[model samples]
Target chain A: MKRIFASAHVKRLFSALAALAILELMTGPPGSALTPTAGFTGSFGEASSFFGIFRTQRWVVFLFLALAMYAIWSAWLMWGTQVRAATAKAVSVPRAASRTRPVRWGMAVAVLAVALLLPHLITDPFWQAAMVEQIAVYVLLALGLNVVVGFAGLLDLGFVAFYAIGAYTTAWVTGALPTAAPFGIHFNNFYAIPIAIALAMGSGIILGAPTLRLRGDYLAIVTLGFGEIITIFANNLYGITGGSQGTNTIPHFSLHVGPIKYLWGLTPVPYYYLTIVFVILFIAGFKLLEHSRVGRAWTAIREDEVAAESVGINPLKYKVMAFAIGASTAGFAGVVTASQSNTIFPSSFTLQFSINILVLVIFGGMGSITGVVLGAIVIQTGSMYLLHTPPAGYQPQDLYIYLGALLVVMMIFRPAGLVPSRRRHREIGLAEKGEGHMNEVLTGDTP
Target chain B: MSDKIFDVDHVTLRFGGVVSLNDVTLHQERGEILAVIGPNGAGKTSLFNSLTGVYQPQEGTITFQGSDAKPMSVIGKKPHRVSAAGVARTFQASRMFSALTAFENIKIGAESHRGIGVAGAMLRGPKTRRDERTSDARTVELLDFVGLRAKANVISSSLSYGDRRRLEIARGLATGPQVLLLDEPAAGTNPSEKLELTTLIRKVRDEMGVSILLIEHDMKLVMSLAERLYVLNFGSVIAQGTPEEIRANEKVIEAYLGSTATETGDRS
Candidate 1:
């Protein structure tokens, strides 16, 4: 059945069209197309009059949510198979290789792409504001960590430390310190973001330095310690930090582009665009670095440090750099983190946060940015919507069941990552190194 | 051994009160095959360890390539650094990356020449991938040269005993080291395989342009492969000379002949 999809020319053509549509939506088609929306903005797309029936509204929301899932799934489909195609052809293409993949992809893109695009047909600001913000923040945070773990291969147990660092940097530096009236400093997220990045990197270096020599388990332990320390400090430091009570009335992101305050005025829309733009920038930076020499350096370190060092690679230095870079992503994440909420507590930077990022890396495939981006969306948003938002009467362990099942299935079937690194897919087999495969795709390949 | 390709001048090694090696000095020429034949605790492997920097000497210096320059004193140097300095060794048990395939293993072994780095490997685009391709081809070539081409894609653990030994040699040679150290080439092989090993060692010495310091217990194999031999009875060398000369030495006779020929086979 699956073979017919690849063997038949007509089916292949349909797949190619679907592939284009998927890429158009997934790659965003150079921004000329109308912006695709999901969640709330998408939820109200079909309704023209003031109010609609509960069923219609519910259906609209469901359609948009499905589209959102499609948007993420399409990217994974396109890049995932594309990489497999590239690698399978490395030695020779087996005629028995997967064939029905394209048909299924076509079916997926045809159904969902229309649903997502439907929202753009409307000009409702509220839904537009909601859907876009959701996608943008996710892409940004995921991409930041993509560089840290995907490219470098350092397993960070305390990535949320940096995320918290970014958030608090915005919170502390921009907002009042509760006793800042005497100091006379105005709150500004503009200054806070960069400072947050710097501070996160500084702390990243500190955390990275001592544990760089240790591999796997030991590195995980030290980073876990660093994360706990950050959370404790945030909790204990009452004078500077708000402590367990949390901070309030924090500012939002504001920037002026050539005398124009492009994304200003505390609104979700501007923050949405602001986040998307930064996500683009992070993606670009990560892409360039992955394709650059540094990306290869990281992969080699991951594969075999001893072998890498024997070939003149300075393992300690590169390992440390990986830790710092990965931490920096968390830091950047923090900046947006603080801004978006305008309030934060140490609870936000819990060990679970660290686990979430690690899960992102694992699911996405270690060493693959595209995989991480896909993983962050599907896992984070999926978990939030599915497990966290049940049809009422949700068990506390509902989230665990969904995540655990997917994780168990993924691990048993595809341990490398949902989307894996390119070279590792061939090197370590699919399940062990899929996430890493995507990273390799993003970075190119070091050794 | 020819006149001094490696010169160990009274080099000694100690692990606390125990002396693993003591005042061992030996040399192998650029093209000759040398063997260190001894019983289990004769410090043959330890000699290779010192030369390759697995264990630093407690005292004394060693030199390579006929220079007055201070001996490289491999004693405290890291294993890889010592390898990069033109010495490569195999373990008593095959020390290899079990996860890596034969081709990948050799490619890793050839990493020294491929200019492979994390950055290069990460990019894995044209320049870096081309490097991988060329090196992989070279790895296949070396594997074929060592007659393990059929097992190139197989995991290191899955290979047969003879194939594993060949893979180890292939990995050692991938470094393109000036000298190759084989701990025991024929220790566990059948008689026919041992004979085949003799031809292979000679072929490696002749073809690879790498000298060899072999440690083995098979007197017949050792006497044939090694042009000159060093016989270690206890912790020190009992005799160092041509196989014929060592064969006729009194210490060699006392160590083996005095032990009674029947007991020698039982102990071995």
Candidate 2:
């Protein structure tokens, strides 16, 4: 291969390859996937599951998939003609040359480049494991919510219902039955994961069924109610779920790659790796889905429901799919939660968890996977690290200080998020322009 | 001159004791400029609203281009669907998407025809990407046609009053409808703009091969632009003929000018 990336002409290079090289040696074997060999008994299973495959031989498989995805994405981008060519042409030299958008190519490139290097410096196994797991959970939630909010233009305040469903599914299937003590299952958590996903998707469709007729506040309230219903069931159903007391003593995740064994035996490392792998796969799946006929139909409805329906797009059909696909995230999260902690609880899947995911979606900039990932880390980590890091005797009132400040700053300085949707920002910015544009620029009714 | 595009057979719209449309019968032919002219409170816009499916008539069979156009069954259908059925309408007020630029607003209406949906805009895949590009290109062409290419990026709200009207027309045209309904193209236009708009309306009809149905109270503009005129009085068609016939009609003169017309070209 030419390896043109080595040339100086490649101005802003991602150090992902370089970081992989050094970590490759530290991880013990070449050609091994980033799947770390960590197990239960208080080790970092999630973390290893996430980065382990990258460090070991299995990385090549993941990399190949990613390369294929990128190639497909690029070819489409290169070949597809723009509908906005009129707008582009309409934008004459003077306006096109305007020096707005202070943060463009250079800054964007720097952010991406730093993302490449930042992974290497993050060597704290505990923190790495936490980061990996956290990223996986949030990204997964964001994907599901994106289908509902971003594609369907439907706001779901109680999205945690699906998450709880997945968790309960995993717990019930992998552990014992309602009749059995402590709820023991014949199948393991790994096997339960797929079933949980299916259950979550089914639950998503069930929720979507009635709610499809509603809009705005009505929809939000219904989703919220659904979330409450799921949590309440978990707390009250002691026979199966252990009630509010919850279930404990769960199993660790285990996987085999070719000749090597990467067992996430109750370690945070494997759990983290597991979460990352799933999150990436989901993102790639969504990337494809977003472009598919179904995805566009969702967005079309999202933008303008009446407009979409006029074009023979039945909004209900696509709306259900969005709900189903989005809820699938919770299923994955459920398996991870059950396997890592060897326990399950209703308290874990609450309205707060739902809101946390929603915040990540908005803060990250909806419709952008990169934005979702970044939002997940920044907002979730900020809450986990900063707000949660209470001073010795920090009371409820005292805790408000940091949160209050963060809220104020977030509202005033960055209403759109750390990285706003480029299209959204531009639309809002340009909407405010024009001295006599209404009269001379374009044609419409005189009024 | 030809068969009516819309044949409203005795539409009797009653509201308790008051009858809004009292046994009204009207016709709008294909590929011709049909102007509905009347004073305020004469149900000029109401008739239009009824035709566009915003307000369903109580009793009427309005057959449009071979099918019943105005029926309560249209109540289930949405505004966009109505627009898609070869009928595009512009609001009397500016109802453009304020968030979108003037160019974008028009493009949206234009793209609404085939590829402006979420699926079309997202994923940047082959079909959607291609559709979007074509839609955008057509939007530019439409903008240019309407002489609003210069203010394409200006938000719909930020545009001057005249430009807003132009934008609305551009947007309506973007729907690619066979029928274009203008509520009042010359309502707020100055003499120069009015003259230009008159020319534009004619060009739109002649060049685009679409039917134009206008509602204008401007007698002079109506006289010059309308090949056929329907004079409305209190939700009823009192006179229907050419400008020359309408001028000579006793009922039209009495309804509009409160006097009987003695000649075909009588003024004042």
Candidate 3:
């Protein structure tokens, strides 16, 4: 084989051919039979299911795709350094230019101004609703989960359970659930905020107190079980949760404090404005927390628990704090979502929802507030767009397949994420250079 | 009221069938450098763990009395509580927050004292800002004390082995403990680094007035630095005296120093 393909060009050709064959096998027509009765007969000469409009053979379609893939792969191999250098220069130039305090402040204000004016720019009712419902809500979720997974390095797979708790708590307080409101107050959703937050935080502490002692995979498993338990209870507890039917009597928010008598109606734009205001407030608070003593304690705990304890930081206390704090944000998001939507089903808080928020956090650069916000907006918008106008052969079920493929590619190229925090980016870089363990970087393991 | 920083007696620790520490008794005085030397599996690290509340003794009393504070029982308390009681320890292996900057690693220890609550942290009131400034100053001072001020911004994982040991010491000092535990501080350093470490240890005692409890396999460094020495063999304290007394004791030589000519000879 060496003698036959001694030249690099010939070697490349052989590898390309092998890749094309594998691609053809995967995307081509299925086998005729599973048993030997039909001799496993199949042919790649069949018309492609994807290119049905063109009536093209499966191999022909796969061949084009394989070639395109090979082209990109080979080009990357040939010019990866130059591409990286060019991007570094492009990014660093702007960063260095904007390093001044005034310049940075100006840029931040510009971004905020654009964010505030977004609803006005998009007049379409469908897009506006999608903005508030999908983008804003998930942004809140990603931010909350980021604290648990990113800052504290705790893998909480049941994060959505807190969101569910928050929503249910709001329902109970607003007299929407089958159960009577506490104190029989039957207050507005705005009044339910503190109660929902407190409930969510209380549950966070309850769950975290026992389970936070388990490290890594064990903790993840316990949290996963907790999420499933919450969902099952929500589905089965008909008297309290209204079961699968859920509740729809939740009223929209209204302000009646001292002549500020504004009502939030069915228009999604008003809700979007409210959500953004809270998002801004949260971002400010989280940003402050990130650079504070609490943040350092979290970082120390995440990095080395024993060392953190040796420095007088109780690891369990900080881990629980991360959970409760993260949960409170989710609870607040739940209040917003529940009041805005009018009805929320147990089906809405699935394990997949938690994973989806996790994906957003990881995709955006787990510890970066701005990164997750951008990630949520881009991903949620993209998914909503697909639902609105899916292309040919793009089944709704196939979204995850595409998303999975994207994540795989992302992990390979940018393991630290698109907008990773400085420490995370450095950690991944060091791990790549073999100076640190990759498991520590990826899974937050001590090793 | 006791002048001793630590008063440990009859500490017996066992894991399953094996007794890791067998009725070990030891004491450390105020502003003194104490060394605990033993061969591998001599329960030196186990004793440190017990002192730090990582492990609980089946039968013992561990009391910590810093210069100003009342003597408090160490057993049954959490590690952080023991730490807050003015005891800080380094690890046998250099455990640093690898991804963080060198300054940040030490700052974590410095700011761990009198932590601003979550609300204050999120709000960034004037008090929080003042605390942060003071923490940064202390962190810088400690880094300079350890001769690592130049490497403040560097990621801790990329530090040299000698530098890592120094960083760990700086981190421990950053906690502002009255008693500092040094676990194999000179294990992986070169000869020149060892000399520097010895000087630094002495400076920590003389200048900072912090008592030192060290576990070391390096006989030469331990003999030169430690005022008092405790020898352990098979999980129990075999001998305890001044270094000169320990150097002459028959049991110490038979248990530890005699084997030193062959195994770990290069280390000394």
Q: Which candidate is the best by lDDT?
A: 3
Error of 2 at B57 (Å): 4.0
Evaluated on CA atoms against the true complex, candidate 2 attains a DockQ of 0.12
Backbone clashes, each candidate: 54, 78, 0
lDDT of 1 by residue, A1-447 (tens): 788766645454565555444433332212333634321222222244333343343334444455665555566666988877788787454433323678655754674564345345635655444434444455565666666666665556777788888887777777545536324676568777678888888887777777776665566678888889989999999887888877877776666668876545355555655665566566656776675445555665565554444443456666677666666666776777567767889887899877766677678876676687778777766655653344322344556545665777687778678887664455456324332222232233333
On residues B58-130, what C-alpha lDDT tens digit does candidate 2 reach at each position?
8867656722444223333555556767677776764555545776666556655463343333345678767
Native-referenced Cα lDDT, model 1: 0.66
**If you assessed candidate 2 against the hidden native complex, which CAPRI class would it receive?**
incorrect
TM-scores (chain A) of the candidates: 0.67, 0.65, 0.88
**In terms of TM-score, which candidate is stronger, 1 or 3?**
3
Give the true-structure RMSD of model 3.
3.9
> What DockQ, on C-alphas, does every prediction get?
0.13, 0.12, 0.67
TM-score of each: 0.65, 0.68, 0.92
**Best TM-score goes to which candidate?**
3
Question: Global CA lDDT of candidate 3, please?
Answer: 0.85
Cα distance off (Å), candidate 3, residue A220: 1.4
Pick out the ten consecutive residues of candidate 3 chain A with the lowest summed lDDT. A37-46
